[model samples]
Target: MLSSWLLVACGPSQEPPENSSLTLLHPNNPSSDTETYQTENDFDLLVSDYESTQRVIWQKPDLVIAQLGDLSGKTVADIGAGTGYFAFRLVPRAERVIAIDIDQRFINFMDSIKVRLPENVQDRFETRLGKPEDPLLKPSEADVVMLVNTYCFLENRIQYLKTLATGMKNEGELLIIDFKKNNLPVGPPTELKVSTAQVKAELEQAGFKVKKTDNQSLDYQYIIVATLQKPTNKIN
Candidate 1:
């Protein structure tokens, strides 16, 4: 049964109302409540929602991670890594996992979980507090970058992607998964979502080439795979 707080959180919360539209949850999923994100005070509830088993049925995390292929020597950055849902999971697979987010509460939450990782893999995880305008990734630092359920909320998405592209290695890949713009049984209201077409176009505008678009995988989301374009040599 969903907790009482979960029921109460289905609607937007009081504080940080600006983030009310950032939730990627289905109403059935306890974490689907957007209220938990309104403030750092609800960290505990937010964790429960993010890590809930119900989310796995719809999130299909393993399949999503599979898209990154073998991460033997790759450094993957998970943007908006609330509660390290994908970050901690990638720790054992990738050479390194940088969990980036704008909220310090989520950052601290991930740090708390980091202490419990197996001794060897513990070092593989790092949490970074990012700014609203920038993710603060170093030049060519990531082999693959991911933004799950956090793309639509971006204010200046094109500019953000341009800055994000600078952080990827040459020929690096980017994986984006977000709720489809539809009246789905779960997820935020349809009007608040971004369509796959818009995402693809923005990726192109930001210097990436769309490699694949998968719309049938998740029940309510679409996956976009794009690669950074290589700089062409110009004759002087």
Candidate 2:
């Protein structure tokens, strides 16, 4: 279970009008990319916020674990794992959990956490520095690759999905959990939000098929699980 998202600052400033348009500054912009947002370390701040929020909002992490099916011996990858939230949750269940993030600082933090990991999960967790367009994992290396509440920040959805498909095993599953545009006060605004329909369509375009869509969570978010399709042309 991820954070409740209630920690978002809600001051007297009225929620931006429903259709309010705010300019989205791309993270990869050559000129403005180096400009930092908040002074606090982004990854650490995000992790602290999420950990606190989840404690307040979510009742069970088991629900998400169960939805992931069997991970007892699977090689799982958590893409955009800010503070290893999902990665840490999965390490006990998976044979190995590859926690990937675009920030090297986050990876370093994850490495620090590795020392105090439970005996069973001691050597099962590894961190990888990834980019927005590429996950950097070898092809067919994972039984599952998950993007939990992090898909919206991806600069290229189609390329990212394609990279994910290539990184997964033939029967692997990809789980994407994100906030519902209409309900969540946290995360990007509605205009920048990626809808369930948009996610499904994008995955399908990347040659994956929707295996399931579940709204079981009581929060303002949803989950979509998609399976990679067997390639038709084997003889290239």
What is the C-alpha lDDT profile of model 1 across 95-164, one tens digit per residue? 9999999888888889988998787887889999998779999999999999997887677899999999
TM-score of each: 0.83, 0.81
Q: After superposition, how far is residue 16 of candidate 1 from its true place, in Å?
A: 17
Model 1's lDDT to the true fold? 0.79
lDDT score at residue 119, model 1, on the 0-100 scale: 77
Candidate 2 on 183-222: residue-level lDDT in tens? 4555545766688999999989888899998776736567
Alpha carbon lDDT of residue 137, candidate 2? Answer: 88
Which portions of model 2 miss their true places by more than 4 Å?
Answer: 1-6, 9-36, 39-44, 53-56, 118-120, 232-236
TM-score for candidate 2, residues paired by index: 0.81
